[model samples]
Target chain A: MNAPAQPVLEVRNLSKSLGGKLILDDVSLTLNKGELKVLIGPSGGGKSTLLQCVHYLHRPDRGDVFLEGRSAAEMGRRNICAFRQEIGMIFQDFNLFDHLDAENNVAIALRKVKGLAKAAALARARAELDRVGLADKADLFPAQLSGGQKQRVSIARALAMDPKVMLLDEPTSALDPDLIGEVLNVVADLARGGMTMLMATHQIGFARRLTREIIFMENGRIIETGRPDDLLAPASESRAAAFCAKLTELLGH
Target chain B: MFDLAYYQTLWPRLFSGFWLSLSTIIPAALAGLAIGVVVGTVRGAMFPRFLVAPLNAYVSLFRGTALVVQLFVCYYGLPQLAMWLKPFFAARGLPELWRIFYLSPYAASVLIFALCSGAYHSEYIRGAILSIKKGQFAAARALGFTQAQTFWNIIVPQAARRAWPGCGNEIVYLIKYSSLAYIVTFKELTGTAMTLANSSFRYAETFFAAGLYYLFMTTLAAWIMRRLEKAYAVPGFGRG
Candidate 1:
């Protein structure tokens, strides 16, 4: 694949530690516009931390993230807020505002941050919810919805922002096995529509089918990066391939 | 024996005192809630130390003291403070500052109740705010909400819902405690009852009637609060 002249998102030597323990070390990756990359590894491999650091939720102790070629390290507090607005984040737990119903959850950021009027924001929210096939569930609170429905509402909430790029940290990890497909379908549709995305997920089969490249991380470092076909080939010696074989054996994928 | 004619005359005076009590309780409750919410949000959200220090002091001071003492300080102690500062005001050519210290019994009673209840209310609100899941805060921040917007729009509303029962208890406490207002010469229900009983030498009947009045007020206030709690409750949140 020919690389774009400038990447839409870039992580430069990002490092982070929690409670005096390093979680991510010297992690660097670039995401060109409209590219969807998957981060795969064992639990506690720093994939979630990498996504969070890029979003500045857990500020990196060292290193920088650039969006559209602007360094986050150089941005002021207000500019950081503006920068965060451009990059949407999805969480493993769905994290829908428990107090708000589905429609309000989708509309809140538009009304609050984007300064869209309530009527316009709600209209936009409805459209986004409709896209997720949850238009009928707009008035339901998070607790009232099933896990799959809740995840879709959260995705609608993130999509309503019209984000330049999206960081999804195990968007389907918290779902019941039978419920995972609905959430994955929405994510797959987003990829097909050319929304730039970086995702950390354990569903190797889904990653193999949809992602442009598969990134393997372990012990706070990226171990290997390659196309799914090349990395997961039966005869390959890559760690990702070995991990996938074990995973496939255990889950019969 | 209940004195029918005497009781008939007492009723009008008791009604007037009840009206005064009502006026005091309403504003004090509203103002106290406003102060509690603002103070609670600031403290819970972990604002800068300088601002938090004084608020911490305010909460500690109010909660630690007796309500009667706080009422006394507002009604009586301020005048003494004014006397001490009279020379300073005079030297500064602001003699009007003395008037600020000379609070009327009514004003002083409301002020004391609001401050004391506000302290308790803030504790409840702060606890509720802290109890919220951290993910919501992270999500709001990730969505580009400023700290203030996240606290007000996302955090505070949910906190308020969780804090509702606690705040409602404070309001009931406020209603019952409004009787103490008469201690400051405010001529509220208890004060009027005391005066009438002393003059008529009818302590038992008069005080019993007063007790009934208080019971009525507390019961009414409790019912109103329950209705409000029901109305304000969001679906799938808080106890039914």
Candidate 2:
């Protein structure tokens, strides 16, 4: 039989309100397996909130998230944790454990959560660190790593879990201008390798280059989504075009 | 008037008492610390729940009461309870293992001191555990670690590091409080010094010697704790 095809993640009619203010209003999206989608929007546009909702970090008020056709809402705690293991998330702040060195941080989930033996976990951790090009810095702590290096270690930490889908919420937003390219390069490489990725970023140029599709969000809703080349072109009527115009002007492009 | 002859007469007795005090204090503090760490981490991990509240209440109740009362309750009350049950009495009364092993007044004092200090130390440990960042907990959860795994692997190590200063201070206080062991007829340093003072009527000299010993011990403790703080200190986070 031929391999089956299915959407790896689906969010439908998702709504969330924080402190009586609606942050996400009936948003819906679908991500096919191995697809790279970029969500680009202005600040306070609910991109991060949407990512959190999909990650099940925040429960949507009125919506359903399905991962591999299974309802996220119906999954018990243990299953939900298992689900989270398959979805790797990279945060804007990196969020590396400060007390642990790079290798220990990567090994923690494997050993403590996955119940892998210490020696095996450490060996896997070293391999992941090596994949991130940080094998020599395994003994260094987060504070010791540079901005790009820290983000790489964060990527390594997430990748060590061997997640099926990766979520990046403005992963390069916290880095300096000089440091952004290095992080973006690593992400672009991941995308090229056909990892299922949903990234929310303000970097329109990088998003345009990396993602097969771009979602432009405004006022807690997705305004438009299409091929990045078509949506980002100057003549396109998509709201993404206007946003890209504004962004390009701001960047003096 | 300070007499060198009085000092000479008092020194041996005071030294003996001091040795008893050290023996009692060190073991008691270690036992108390172990109890506090375990109980406090469990309470902290169960926080915002009814279980944590009751444990917190238990800690407060013990801490709020005087150490003297707690000591009496353990030593005196437990025996009555022991005597009430025939099976318990048979097991614990005649030639009991505890009795055989802990025959000295010093051992009884250590047991009492451990229970008394354990209550207060638990609160310190709970506060330290609470001080860990919320992100740390979320990260642990995201990593698929169960509650127990997170507590042991992440929370306990961090809390232990943060709670070290408080624990060190508690140890010094424990040393000072071991003087209370003298009340139970333990001839620890303070008890020995008191007997010597009674005979020679040299209260000031005996107390001065005790004071010097405490100062020396506390200074040494402070130095060791400082070194530990430096060793475990998170780089870029500065001293705890």
Candidate 3:
């Protein structure tokens, strides 16, 4: 018999190339329920591409992604919209809809995709905004919000769907130094609340503090995978460990 | 001059001519707008090369040539074509059919106005659609909006708001150019002014009055556009 509880996400030999350059080369990873995984890498190392491919934002040239054992390839264009409901993605630039206010931003998917009525969507939107600590800022448009606040609202927008997994692509990379803490704090709370997440980020210190699985990538491949303590141990042993050590030292972990 | 006798006669003629202009321009502008939307949508979809090339050629054909020339072709040239089709009509026992091609100025003018103006409108609307950020498209899809839902609900509303200033300019252009109605023996604002000026030989007053009417109409249009731009402007986004 198939296992009653499959992994929340599973990938098999995913590969993607952009402009004839291999960005994600035959990569595979898995996540169980309540697991937090961090993808740490240099720029152009394919962390973002992997997340996007998993979400079908970019279709993989090869391999398959399974959400709870259902292959992404099996989903049609119509099916993809429905499939996306289970996954919430936050972007580096916090791609909130500029035309809508915070409440409408979160509520739109609920109303349009989930078929919730206006008042119900608004009510659900407000609850999620409250969860992200932006209950009062519901009326503000995306352009009116600060970088941190925009990210929190995006998180709220994602959380409002009650998704199974959240894909965060450099969630704090675009924020100012002082503003980074607030956005990371929200992610930490989601982690604590047991949200399954795959985050691509550079803040090694936050990854250290969160105690998640660390997957260090380089040149479109997963070079190392281990717990933070093992990867950031005192000795600059392996290439990944050496990289982690340098990053941790610079990041003041 | 505040001459009541002259005002009475001139007012009726100009008013009647203005009505003719309005009746002609409204339907023609609307037709133009409809054609523009379809053409613009095709352009924005970025279809396969074969299809897009022909659409590009159509836009260029209309845009590159002058409106007056296009109008003349539709009004005058069609009858010349009709002469050749006359033999086919006579053999088919549809003799009157060929004469129907002796197009009414009104029909010809409307077709000409719609086709000519629609070309420009498409460019305005297409530019507005293109200006929408790629992030917005990604964001909509990420939110689980189907492609159609995203276009109608998110993209179109924003693009329409952005396109308003140009659309307003087009409407004003329609009002001024409706004066060309007289070219086909249809008297509109300028036609009325010309007839009254030629008969009365009061060139200064008649033309000046007609010019004032245009100024008033354009000013009113400008004011409305300003309000629309203010109302529809995206909050704290694009514009400073």
Candidate 4:
């Protein structure tokens, strides 16, 4: 049979080192269009580093990341910006501009980058906030929001960009237990809605339920990759099974 | 020798001097802050690396030198330099007007003071810009903002709030440094007090009056800045 169609995002020998310590070492992956890929690994295994490289937040030290077949490393500033418009990345810290209220935070990129008029941006912001179930919180500053709410606002801000691909880096990790469910619910809804996403997370059950494919990483390398059930099934000998067992023990699951 | 009568006698002269000082201080401080915001934003945005380095060098040179030197340069040095280029300036028919504008000691002093303080203020502004979390810039970029749009729309306003306290300190220093303008013969509050004290031979009383004026001005400035800080601070966020 013919090889499956090329993925929407393709990595070829991508590598990065921070201060002479290898953070990502010769990592390669393919993300098919509309695929929900979960990257699960022990801490410092370079899952977030991989997402950041894809987001162009950190340039890979060696090799290439291609977005829709265009080399991200070769794109100039303007092209990079245009490429970024189509790819949204959420942070664990929820990096909202504190001076802006929730609505303005969402509206800013629309107004400044998209060149939308203020009224149009504001309307779009309101719509996105409503989607995140935060219509009433539009005027609230990030400082006023709980960790979960801030993360949701960050999600809305990303969604407002109308991105084709979204990368979430430990989206619920910073939230309190009571708040984690709220953010995870939002991500679940997005995944169910068929938004293309790459999420690095420790929420193993959520990963298994929400994602079609799961990739297990160790020491800056992909140790195993397969369908979620195939790798997570009781009879599996995949390294992912051992990794999940250890993670479950660590999380007291 | 302590005399309530001396204070009474000194009050009017001191009051007039205070008013003169404020006239120079307020306008120069306002102008300096505006220039600083522009320069700081430009430098922070890292526009045209060539331009940024030279602008940075200019800011550093002014901040590194004494304000007195800047005043002397603007007042005494500029005219000499202008005369050297008189052939070019006169051909353009701008030299005479420029000389007339600079001839007034008060105008030249205020101009120099504004330029000097603006340089230091820009440094504070740059520091504030740099202090913002890197993640904010990343988010802006991810949202499709160009470098310029990210700075003006997201960064500068946030940095302004962060930079306010430093800018307030600069404002207080500007007021105090207005006294230096007396050297250029501007006859502001300190200049008037000095001349009056010399003429009256009551140095202690006249100088005491000047001190009181400064105390009042500084107190008012501090109060206003505190209010500003409270207004701009994100509620529930730590002062960091």
Clashes of each: 0, 3, 0, 0
State TM-scores per candidate: 0.92, 0.83, 0.94, 0.83
lDDT of 2 at A114: 82
Clashing pairs in 2: B17-B188, B17-B189, B18-B189
After superposing candidate 1 on the true structure, give the runs of residues whose Cα lies further than 4 Å from its correct spot: A1-6, A245-252, B87-99
Question: CA lDDT of A62 in candidate 1?
Answer: 96
Q: Which prediction has the highest TM-score against the true structure?
A: 3
lDDT, candidate 1, equals 0.91
What tens-digit string does per-residue lDDT give for candidate 2 at B1-240?
998777666656677777767778888988999888877876766656766777677787777888777656665566565456546547666554333332356666787788767877887898888888876776676666666777788887788877888888888888788888777677887788788778878899888887877777778878988898888887644463
Provide the lDDT at A197 for model 4. 88
Which sequence of candidate numbers ranks them by DockQ, best first? 1, 3, 4, 2
Q: In candidate 4 chain A, what residue range of length 10 has the lowest lDDT sum? A: A2-11
lDDT of 1 at B85: 86
* Window of ten residues with lowest summed lDDT in model 1 chain B: B231-240
lDDT of each: 0.91, 0.82, 0.85, 0.86
Comparing 1 with 3 on lDDT, the higher-scoring candidate is 1
> Any residue pairs clashing in model 3, and if so which?
none
Candidate 4 structure quality by residue, lDDT tens digits, B71-133: 888778878876777677788877365555345677887787788778878888988888888
Cα displacement (angstroms), candidate 1, residue A81, comes to 2.2
Where is the poorest 10-residue window by lDDT in model 2 chain A? A2-11
Q: lDDT by residue for model 3 over B105-212, one digit each (tens)?
A: 888878888887788888888888888888788877887889899988887887787776787799789778877877877777888888998998877777777877
